[model samples]
Target: MTTARPAPPRPTTAALKVPYRRPALLERIGEHPAGIVAACWVLLLAILCLLAPVIAPYGYNDQDLGNVLAGPSAAHWLGTDPLGRDILSRLLYGGTDAFVGIVQVTLVAVLVGLPTGIAAGYLKGAFDAVSSRLADIILALPSLIILLLLFAIDPSARTAAMITLGLLFSPSLFRIARAMSLQASQELYVRFAEVSRVRKGLIMLRHILPTALPPVVVNLSLMAAFALIIQSGLAFLNFGVLPPQASWGGMLQDAQMVISEAAWMMVPPAVAIGSLVVCFITIGDAARDIVAAATTPRRRSRRGESLEVSVGSVDAEESIVVAPSPTALLRVRGLGLSRAASGTEPAAPLVTDLGFELQPGESIGIVGESGCGKSVTTLALLGLLPANITVDRGEVVFDGEDLTTASKSRMQQLRGRRIGYVSQDPMVGLDPCYRVSNQMIETIRRHSDLSKSAASERAIELLRSVQLHEPERVMSRYPHELSGGMAQRVCIALALAGDPDVLIADEPTTSLDVTVQHGILQLLEQIKRDKGLSLILITHDLNIVPALCDKLLVLYAGDVVEHGPTLDVVTRPRHPYTRRLLDCGLHGVERGEPFPLIEGTVPHPGTWPDGCRFRARCGLATAACAEPGARAVRRDGAVIARCITVREGASEAAALVGAVRTIARPVSVIGDDPNAEEADRG
Candidate 1:
């Protein structure tokens, strides 16, 4: 029997003539009208400055005593300065100094600030504290006063002024860079890189720097404008450049004396300053918009007319399971995650007194609006949270092992082997540089005793299992080559490499088009059934839960406000928050009208309400709702909703609570008690 050999790895997307293309810088700038205008102004001024000698009618300093302080005339258009030099010529020549000085100062500042600030942010502690304090002290000193003082100490220290100004300006850059760095440091990719033990420098350069660049680039453009203003101001005060050489500020200073007789003298320099400043500011704004667009994760436009819940077996468990069953594959109790106080900020909780249980083959959907700790809860469970975010009060017992106390090595062993994770964005989840098969093979090899060839075959097999046509062709393609749906499929395959029992998908369908989202969701459902994998789906949209989750966990400001079966919770929401979410969906929407939305936003950490987290937005909130440690009330002897009115079975509350219990009894209710295991067992 002849064995058919696997097809050789197909040509990559690059070789297949589907080369990735990015718009050229000029083209990108031209897309925005403001950027085009600013660019034209900058280019016009730059060309005029560069070719001043060739374009100007006369030398900048050429003195014609006969026509000093002359107004606009045929001989000297834009009029002559007090020195009889052509004003147009002087203006063109003067730009050279301003442009050169600002460029030099900006370059110096960025060079000094970028590394220092990034370092301070990533390597937080004594170095960061000391550097931040020093920067604060430096920024406190007045720039004009400092420049004047430096010039007073030594008049010939003109170059010293440039260096001093650059140094002085660096503190601002440092602050901006540091702020961007801090934000970038918190990015999922950066934290993931740290967990993977990727080199620190590589993490900062590859992951942190790219995300941080947008803000820094915007600041740099604005800083250039500020530099010009300051440079001109100093020159106006005679602290910058010496005469015979005409600077824009010096021209302004000279023109001020003769303004009464020769008003034209001030026009050229004043217009130059004003026009350039406006151009810089405009360009900065345009650049900011461009950078923001480029850096932000693009959400593919939804193609479907409407996004309705996908109904299937995952929507509701058919098996009659009682509450607090002993068959939980993963159990979490008092799972609190927090970030320590920094500077003036108080200790903030990301996940407070959270608890949940995932039964074998059960799919639980953690639904809430953004910032309700759904993602944090996932990270806390997997031991993948950032360094600063501590598991303050939690025990994540998975497969009978408490992961909170697990060593780094032990957690790493379990992460990809027993528990898999699919991140929000597939583009970030898979390294762009590596081919699809390369990442998969590496992952397979990491946890399994598979050789290179076996691992390669295994990767191909995995890709095929995920329903990719021509798996060999896809194996050689990079992340960017695949569409969002295809990339997410690849991520799913990677997550399943170890045949993990539980899959944690964090917004798996986010940023995907509606059609693609349906496909991905269908794929997840298929995989869960085939592999018998328990899934923890974290998403904000309520519609997504009913299709893929057996149970629903409704979170509000880090608190589980309601927990029950997905179908039960959706059809008859016990809590006002749960009902509000359901109302935001298509169920309550009128044809061709705006859908009703939840009124207030989720409360931020450290600002959660005293009693129930959702009380601030709850219409039924009363004086009793303001008290802390609000207890969960059992409704229909199953579903848990944390509300005093619901607990008391008030007349108004009956309408909402009664509707919920009419559908189905809750399989289990995740409650507010820190000792949630004991509470559930009761």
Candidate 2:
């Protein structure tokens, strides 16, 4: 007779009650000189521009013949222009116009160009080709000529020039946006967003757009400087402002006639234009430096403080609770994804007829070799696949909503709220420029209607909940200042900020040291128990699955070959891919024993065979195995194997099991060599 196992202990309330601490943005600002300086300069300029009307003594274009060409004096500081206008007054007024024009033009360009570029880059092929051609045509036209032509026809030259500038600059913006979007689209975070049932727009805005912003922002700054120069150039050419409109460019145009006689006329406005341009360039340079520093990888000293905090107490005897009568939280049925081929042959399907069901609070581990469609499957679920391939036939149902047809806004609402994600590379997943506190706060505020104080408090609590030490201090630090382990923990905290029901962790601890990896896994386990959160853990390492996952899915060449309870799959894998993966985990070996390796590389979908996707790699393949459909064998509960042969002799099965088990034992050192024997004797 079999005895049933005891139920797992409920997570203690004390472990769930994490104390809140306020985030200190000021502390982070103090540490970053470049960011502080750039911010200060921008703030100062904004204030000055706002107060320009109040501070100036006369109208920007006010004239006085008596003060014409006057040198520096108490009433006319820095001297008067040839037109007798107060140089100081004109400079102040000019700044206001420049600021307005720069802001308006840049906003228009970014608003229009960013979306267009992101769309073109992310959705390549015909769309990309058309957009690229259009961008090329627009870029080829001379912006000045277009502005002049529009201004001649329309009286509102300012608007005409602004529009012309936007049209001219948009192509460059699109190119940069597209390039950055393409790069970010490949990131695991983007993949995580896709798999998390997040909408494309939210992923574009929160994940892809933010990651794409660094380069775009850098370009934007340069463009602001360019916009100002272009405005001045237009004014100088007599195309910008008509007479009686005192712009710096207009002043410069008039000063050219009297330069030799009244050199002071040319000096003042020239200096003003040069100084403003210098300020923008300086600010841009500093911003570029800050962005670079933020993205730069730092060598974290081992002596720095560790972020891990112990759970109040861990009960070793606590058995994990496997939810009974589990209901599906996520379901993927008849899913297929494929990329179009170049040659005459039919397009290749990357994922074909893949299906899976995730129950609430269940930890499902996805294990596979590289390029086995594990990541691709997750991406397709999230609607984050690359533009080339299409989701041929499938439905991803989450909380009764079919995710495949979910709108961008709906997906955004679900992401970071109902579903959170932790990626393999935390650094890529995180925004480097943001402090840990800010990132956590943003994540919380994105989904919840929390006040700043409340969001900050929650952010700190999440940092502590993730077992991070010095939670307050860590909150004040940027991503670059934190260690790899610390950053990953911060990422976990960010994911947890929204109190999501499901957390999809894609190799969350891949780059961490062994000790940190174990601690992180423990934190995940502790959190799962406390929150009753479900997890879909995507990992190549099977060693981690036994400790963290209850169910396992083995994928090869984008198909689910074997799936069952974690223990059962690990102990007795029926699929060839599963057997190879298990064999790879066994370390001990006799001298001269042949080390096993999976024979062929994963077949590229473009050249994939018509039969079983894995038949090429299977040693047990026969003529019958070349059939179109997979043979399903059902075992205990829902355990299923999609193989042709599952009725092997008991002895044969035991021999295979014993072979792997013998190799699983650790090797002992023997006194074979003289040096070993001498050392032993000593």
Candidate 3:
């Protein structure tokens, strides 16, 4: 309901269209050719290294004194090192150690740095001050000097040295995670989640962590290369893996010693280390590109482009706009819409001629099925219709001021301050970019003279008034943090921020479960009783009318087919469409008893039949209804019926409803089975 529904006539619609999609992991990875090739090579290298013991031609320690310095041959494919060890075997075995060390170092850095940085950035205050200083100190320490000290103390400290190296690498990761976390924390999505009542850890995992992961992944890849280089440097200096173990750095040292004697010796280890490092960096770049490509395109369809009905007569629903009460709190006189022509699409009326009155402290439900103009009518009152839809004729008079012709500044003054709005979805309604406290308090202060502190208290009071628990706790949470019911309540509280006289809720309970819907209805009823606030509710649910609305307006195909007192209308609806709406509503039927239903969907805009708009679906539609000018004829003061049969000649007490059996009739679509419904339910 966030988007305005198209009323008849030329309503606005979007001009451009684009599809949105998120590519899968393998698909994203395979998209980059060089990245895929690099990934394959890295995978192959790891597999060969892990299987070194079972597949290598000879043991890394099996010396071939006779083949020493020999080129590729049967005895040794990659010649021999200075110690006469097989170069190929050494290379394979050495990779196992390099692979394990790189993974270990990278994991340690990510585990330690990412979380700490996130905590410092998000939790701030004392934790921020302390962690930031600690990271700075760690960065300041000489990494090489500390490792040398450990190596001097124990030469076989390979595991200890790599662990120390990971620690040394962590500060840089910490800085990156911290900066990214800081930026992510300020995002509206993040604040709405936490300030509205979400867990800090969940916020970190769902929002802040995801935001920082891509860059952190690239950093981690580079860190892996750094570890390999550091491991090679350490082993070259004889401080890496001891003689019994194969180390790439130690192998490189062996190759360097014999380089002048056998220059080919340096090639194997040099290529291995360099190639693996390049693979990691390339994969990192691929990851960044994949994410960028997946997230860029956005979709926004024009809500005014309504579904069309294939079959229709030469004309549409006859235009009608009823008069309004001059002294009412708000009077909507002939509010109609027509979509402007665009491209090849012709100008057409979707919703035309709607008029209603709202008295002080009264609740009026604009009842209708989907596509019946309920939502768009509400949007029209707010002057929030889509760009392609224009108000062809109407005057939304609010307390003597015509809002339809009101300036932007004038409308802004009345919107949130004098006329609060609760949208269909509470989560989307709340501007969560700012923290809950800040957003609520600011809105409260905007229309009032309350101080910041007082406004903050008022925000909590508003939440409590809406029956939300721990209002204070909710103020610190984000949108995703709140439950469905909680989200609705949060929306209600925010709408009440300005303490406006009128509250316009558009299908507020549409997405809620039965229990939650009842709770919301009760809350609204209580609010009206306590505050004397006039409520203009837009809904498809008729059951809510008597409980909340003092008056009712039954709309169909963008026309008000019935408008009268809630009790008078719901108890005995005059229009056939309104009667069908009540019959299709929830009833106290036992199991196996079929629930009533309307056979066909609402006709598309500009496609209603010549006479009555509901005639196409009405079971009692007579040939007389086909006449073009059969609009609503007044029955009682503001009470009217669009059905021609109930015109000037009808008695005031004459039953407006057709026989109940007519409403319970079977599907009338050309091929639909009349018994299909009873069979399914039975």
Q: Which is the leading candidate under lDDT? A: 3
What ordering of candidates by TM-score runs from best to worst?
A: 1, 3, 2
Write candidate 3's Cα lDDT for 1-682 as tens digits. Answer: 1231222332122222222223356766666889889889999999999999999999989887877788877778888877678989999999998998898898888888999999888888998898889889989999888998998999888788888888888988898989989998998999899878999999988788877777888898899888999888888888868775787888877778778999998899999999999999998888766655454342323544432232221223333444556558988877777777542233567676787788899989999999899888888888788888888877888899888888888888988888999999887787766667777888899889999889989999998999988999989987777888998988888888888889999999988997688788878888999999999988887766676788889989887888888777765667888878877755435569898789988865645555577887888888766554455344644467677555333444444332222222211111146564464344
Q: Over 4 Å off in model 2, which ranges?
A: 1-326, 340-346, 589-596, 629-637, 648-682
1-682: candidate 2 lDDT, tens digit per residue: 1232333233341222222222134533344466566557666765665687898877777888898888889988867878788877776676676677788778888987898888777767898899889998988988877777877886346865786687788888898988888888888988988899988888777766655666777788788888888888877777667667667787788778888877777886787667666666666655554454444343332343222111222122221112322378987766777776421123556765566678888888999888888888877666677777777776788877888888878888888888888889889877888887888887788878999899988888888899888899999998999998999999888888778888988888789986677677878888898899999889887656776788898877766777788776776667767877766653443459887678877765544443456777888888766443343333334455666555333355774664445222211121124353233233
Q: Local distance difference test, per candidate?
A: 0.76, 0.71, 0.77
C-alpha positional error of residue 564 in candidate 2 after TM-score superposition, expressed in Å? 1.4
Per-residue lDDT of 454 in model 1:
98
The TM-score leader among the candidates is: 1
The RMSD of every model to the true structure, in order and in angstroms, is 21.7, 22.3, 14.8
Residue 504 lDDT, candidate 2, scale 0-100 = 86
Q: What is the lDDT of residue 248 in candidate 1?
A: 94
**Which 10 successive residues of model 3 have the least lDDT summed?**
662-671
**Candidate 1 local lDDT, residue 183:** 82
Off by over 4 Å in 3: 1-326, 343-345, 432-434, 636-638, 647-682
Using lDDT as the measure, name the better of candidate 2 and candidate 3. 3
